[model samples]
Every structure is written in C-alpha cells, then in structure tokens.
Target: MAGRWTLARGVIHERASALDWAMDSRPRSDSRARECAGLGDGLSPAELSNLTPRAQIAEEWERVRLPESDRKLRVLIVGGAGVAGRNTAASLSKFCPQLQLVIGARNKDKGVQTVSTLGGNSEFVHVDINDFTSLQAAMADSDLVVHAAGPYEYADTKVLEAAIESKTTYVDISDHEGYSRRAKSYMNKAIAAGVPAITNAGANPGVSNLMAATLIHDAQTENRGQPQKLRYNYFTSGSGGTGPGVLSTTFYLLADEAVTYHQGEEKKLKPYSDKRSVSFGEGIGERDVFLLNVPEVASARRVFGVPTIDARFGTAPFFWNWTLLAVMKLLPVEILKDRRIVQFLSKFAYPFIRAVDVISGEKAAIRVDLECSDGYNTSAIFSHQRLAEAAGTATAAFVLAVLEGSTKPGVWYPEEPEGIAVEAREKLLRRAAEGAMEFQITKSFCRRKEKQGMKLGWIN
Candidate 1:
C-alpha cells in the first residue's frame, strides 16, 4: 500500500486511478502465452528452443538460489531514508557484505542519518525523484537502483523514466497502481533500452501479485475441465519492523475512495464506510476489514479473469481503523490538497501512526483464497513481516541475478515467472523450511450445490 498518513482523503482517488491504469495496461494472458511461445524476435526456432534446456532453467533456478555472491557490487538505494529502503539496504549490506551501498535522496542529512543508523557499508547522495537531471546524476555508475522514496502520485514518473535511461536494473517497494502502470507503460522502452525494471516489488504488488499469479496458474491447470472463479483477499495486520512505515501507511492516507475492478469495469465507492470482517489465519482469528483497492486485486482480475476480486485491510484495534475511515469521509477531500496539510500530516500524524505500529509490533498476515472446480477451494496464509522482508531481500537478490546474467531478460511483474518469481519462490520456500517464516499452503475438498449448498466454515 502507499504509506503517507497526511494524504488520507483524496489520495484514494489518485491511488485508484493508478491501479486502474496498471490493470488496464496489463497484457492479456493469451497474448503473453503467444509472446512466450516466440521467445522474442532474434532467435531462430532451433536456437530459441535450445536457449536453455527445460531441466537446466528449472534446476539452475532452484539450486543456485539468491542473495548471490561476495563480489563487490555498487548499489544505489533511492529513498534509502524511508522504511523499505533502509530495511532492504540493511539486509543487503548484511547478506552481501561486499555491496558498496549508496543512499540517494533529496535530503542529504536524512540519507546520511539512515546509512549511519543502518551502520552499513554505505554512503549518501542527494537526488530528486521528479528531477531527471538529479536522478541521472544519482544513478550514475550504480549497478542496481532501488526506488524507495515515493507517494508516486501524478508527479513521480520521471524517476522511473530516468532509471530506464540510465540503463540500471531497477526495483521498487511500490504499491502505487500508477507507478506500476507507468513502469509497465515503458515495457518496450525498457527492453529497447536493455534494462530490467521490476515494478510493485513490495508487499502487495510484490509477493501478493506473485501469489495470485501462481495460484491462478495452478488452478487453471488443475481445474482445466471447469470454469473457475477466483476470489482474492489480501489483508495485513500492521506495518513491519521498518521505520517510517511508508509503504502501507500511504495507502491508508489514500483510503477515502474505494476503487475495484468489477466485471471488467472500474468501480468506485467510499472507504471506511464499507466495514467488513475477514478471517486471516487459523490461530490469528478473524478481524474487521475495510475496502482498499490493492494493485494485486486489479492485476489478478485482469490476468486471471476472477469475477470477484477484493483487497481488504485489517488493523489491531478495530475501532481505530473505523475512526480513521470516518475522518477520511468526514473531512473535505480537497482541504488536504494544500501542501502544508501533506507536510503537517507527514510530520505529525505519520509519526503517531508509526508509533502505534512499533508499539503493536506491526505483526501482520495475508490470506489468499482461490475457489475452483466442483466448488473446491485452496488457500495459503503469509506473514506480513516475513513477506515485507522477503519482498525487499528476494527482489534485490533477483535483480542482482538478472544483472549478472543468471536469468533471461524480459518484461516481467513480480508474479510473472520470468526473472524473479521463480527464484524468489524457491528462496521463500527455503526460508519457510528453515522455520524463519511459517507459511501454510492447503488444498481442501469443497462442494457447491444447486440453490442452497453446503457452506464451508470460514474463520470469521
């Protein structure tokens, strides 16, 4: 989710617009299948067929793993002062000790302080997200560029454009629909420019997108004989250990409006006003949820054609979530348009919310449910803290692998099985195997009857 606390009213409208753009811009599954069938223009059928043996691509992807090697890599952490940026940068520095990390931001003091606090082998430089010149200068000679600083509103497309121009492999912890769409809008440009850029590399857009893609692909295969209906629910309990909590909090600030893709058309509604409850996991129990159009729902619907798609949010204190929503609805949507409001919210409200996250540990979880064939259902529950770290770590690892020529180049989202998804999934499984993150995958027998059928017991 987008995480600025101040833009709590009208930001939803902008966020929805961005999400719509990404969903609308997505290439259909059939078209993608055809494109993959070709493997691009250059290779002859024989060469393309032999680019890598089926076993090789699979075995290598699984065995080689991520967080690559000990080689000295110059990495640029854009928005390194922000939560995701610092958390990712710190992890990178720890795992890849040789990485020459640099924090690029408009605020040099903050950047310096971030690197200092992270205590990594890193430095800082000033760079503006909307300024092409500054971005170009900041990205110079960087092996990888992680765009962390964003509200990604109508204004921040240039940072991404500049990344393409700089020919630097890029990744972002962005939940902004527009950011993902704008990034995808340049698919040809990125390919033409010979640069690899992965969008929505954060939680929802990152892991959630990948999870939805994987589940849909499997269901379409397993239930090939029947028409499948996909219903998606992505819920988070709180922001993780990362400071600033910029990623998820920003989405709340923008939650005044509800935007969802219904029957191939975009629909809008008021937020907070539509209160609902959803079961997260077995032991964690059920909690209150509210509508927030996550990028995954629209992307999944477009890619999977799921009739009912929903992305919901739940918090620790149910009333707090409701109150926040009420405030968003009661306030003048445009009154916050004033820069001072954004600044004020950013400075004060943002800190207060972050404090809550810290006090509460921001412990979170996500449940993805898929219904298919003869009313059969399957699902998986993922942890927010683990997912957030994996989003940053695995994304960085895969980007590095792509740069190092370990994976084939192509336009890909986090969920698409081209560059990162496969490798990231493997790493994620290994993490689960190590008991670092307890993730459960289940398959259940479900039956749907005529008018009134048997209903499965859900957590709520």
Candidate 2:
C-alpha cells in the first residue's frame, strides 16, 4: 500500500495502510516489526518487502538549509563585562575561531579587560543598553548580538529594538517571564528585518526547554501517546557563584506569582505555595522544588502542545528557599513588585547570600519530566559542577547554532523548532552537555521520593 510519513515533534507519523496494519499487528520486540516503524526507503512495496531488517530505510527529511555565503561573521555581546557575558565570550573564542567578537559594555575598563582575557580577534565597544543609539551603532558592524546584561525584570526592549533596527541576529539569557514575553512580541519586526532573535537562552530556560522537547520527542517516537504533563525542576548551590545580578533576578522572581498552563489554559499560583519533591537523578538526587515565574512554562506549553506545564526551582543550603517563602508571606504585593525596593532588599541580603555561596559552592542541575498516555513517562536530567560555566556553555551552543545558520529569521524560544533546527539540536545538545556530571534521558517507571515536604528541607 502507498503511504507517506511526516515528522512532527521529532517523531515519524505514518499514514494508515495495509502495510501499516500488518506492521502494527506484529510484536514490537521482533526485529522485522521494529524495522517497520523506521522510515521506509523510497522503493516499491515489492522491493521494500524483500529487504532485510538491517537494510530497512531511514527517512530523509528536509533541513532548514541556509544560502552559501563566505562573509566573515561578527558577534557583539552586550554586557560583555559581566560574568556570564565574559564566559560566553571565552567559549565563543575557544570554540568558534572563525567569528570576530565584540564586547559591548557601558564601562570601558571592564570591557577592555574582558576583551584582553578573550584575546584573538576580540575587541571592545562602549555601548549602553539603555542608549538605543549607542546600541544600534555598536550592532551596526556585527552580524549577531547576544544580550547578557540583564536582571530583565523591569527591562525595556531597547537592545532588542536596536538589534532589529540594525538587522542583526539576537539572543539573550533573559529568565524573567515579563521580559521574555516582551521580547517575544518583537517576532514580526525581527522577521521583517530578516534577523533571528532568541530569548530565555540560558541554562534553566534554555537547556530545560530543550530537555522537555527531547523527552516529548522520545515518547512520541516510542509510540507513546501525546504528552499530558510537563514539569521542570531546577536547583543551584548558592547563586552559582554569579554576581549580584542573579540575586536580583531571583528576588524579583520570588516576588511574582507563578504562571502555569493547565488544561490548555493559563493559571496563576501563589509563589512558593505548592511544593514538590523532584529527583535530579544521580549525584544531585532529590530536592524540594517550589513554583516560580519562569519563562519556559509558556514557551514549552505552546511549543509542545502539552495541556499542563509548570516550572519549579530550589536552591541549596535549603534555608534560602525558606527565606524566599518567608519573604513571599511577609512582604506586601506592592512592595514585592517595586523594582527599587527589591533591588535594595537584594543588596541588603547580598553579604549573607554571598557567604552562603562560599559555603555551598557552585553546583547546578535541571530535570524535565513528561507524562504521556498509557503511563508512559520519560525524563531528561542535566547537572554541572558550576552554574556559571554551564550557563556559559549553553549560551555558547546557541550562539554557534545561530552562526551556523540554524535559526530562521524570527523571535523564538530555544525549544521551538524554528529557533534551533533538528540538525543543529543534536550538535547544540552535545556541546551543552559537555562537562555535565550527569546527563541522561531515561524512562521513569516509578516516581522516586526521597523527601516529602518543606519540613525535610532542613536536613540537606
């Protein structure tokens, strides 16, 4: 019987036919039966039927191919003086020597220092994100821009607007929900300018989003039904040795209500109210995770079509989480929402937070679980010894993909197919997974519970 196969969510869907029926009727464990699930070769049924199991066809899919061009690519990193930005510059310099690198910073000394540290075809440009003219001028000479200078909670779209105006590709590690949504609103303008822009391209939102996509893909490929739920759990040991910007970001996140999508509709939950125990697999084991306003929830829900999606995060030296809970309970909504007050509070707590960082060291992990029909569940876990390095690596992987012409001219989240094509996904994953102490995708049969509630947080 004549039939066609289509690829969606990284799975092949075959049109029903007599051959399909025959293939389904056979036991999945049988080698010949397994071959039937594979993409069949472009041959007549008679020819296909005579082929051996080892000779079964692999489907040829269309790739998002880019035009052949030999122009030298240049990447300008906004906030290149910061820790994450410096790490991204270093990674790009080490991994992508073909590209010219520019560091955009408001501080000339810091920018020069970062450039000196990165060496080789790297230079510094004095440009402030708040100054659109300066940003646009800095971006004018570059092919792409990576925005790493952000708390992003109260950020405007100045840098993004500048990039669009300059017709330069853009990427940012923004984790704030509001800023991410705002950045996403520039999709049309980005496409019109023929520039690809990606937001939430950091570790949790970036790698976590990709993990969810991969799990869904794996489940569908195994004939598991559509995913019904997706849960993201993340953990970091004491601010991951990053500077005060992360602390400010976390404080702002704690102040906001968590947004989750349930039954294909949006729902708001009280921050730090509903908590769950999630296992980050070996090494990291189990930890308590609480609801947070992360960007991945909405992005994953829309991209994967999952009915229920939520993201939760926890920190090591567990009292930090309790402190956030306490702040959420004690602080007024207006106070929590005030950026100035939040910044002041974060600064006040910085000394203690930094001390915790000294004690906890920098370790981070992310777990993404997907539940589908027939009790089929799959998860992907990634852990690194240091959060800053992991974030840098993940961001660098995305930059490389853009430089390699993987993304289309549109604003997208990392998990979206248009943001990173299937051909580039594997390469990006490989690069990001480097130096991860634990990185694996597994079928979870039973939910493991090492601890139950907030009361247990004291022990770890």
What are the lDDT scores of the predictions, listed in order?
Answer: 0.56, 0.76
lDDT of 1 at 273: 43
lDDT of 2 by residue, 1-460 (tens): 2222211222222322213222111113454344454545575565455433321111221222223558767899999999889988877766666568899999999999998888678899998888888998999879889999988888898989999998989999998878888998999999999999899998878988888877787777777777899998899888786777888888777777899989889999987768898887556778899999888998887788899998898988889888888888888878877988888987888788778777887889898888886566666678877898889878988888887788999899998889988567766875676556656555533223423231211112
Runs in model 1 deviating more than 4 A are: 1-71, 117-121, 224-256, 263-265, 336-340, 384-391, 394-411, 419-424, 428-437, 447-460
Q: Residue by residue across 1-460, what tens digits does model 1's lDDT show?
A: 1111111111122122221111111122544334433432464555444322121121122233235556556788888876667767755655555678888877777788887865556889888776789889988878778887765544466767887888877777667665677677877887888877777766556656655665566556666334255444554444444443444344344543656665556677665446666666543567777677556666666556666666676666555576566657665767444444555565665566557765565555666777665765556555544435645555555444555554334345676665454544544433222211334444444444444443332222
- As a TM-score, model 1 comes out at 0.73
User: What is the alpha-carbon lDDT for the whole of candidate 2?
Assistant: 0.76
Candidate 2: segments with Cα more than 4 A from true spot: 1-71, 445-460
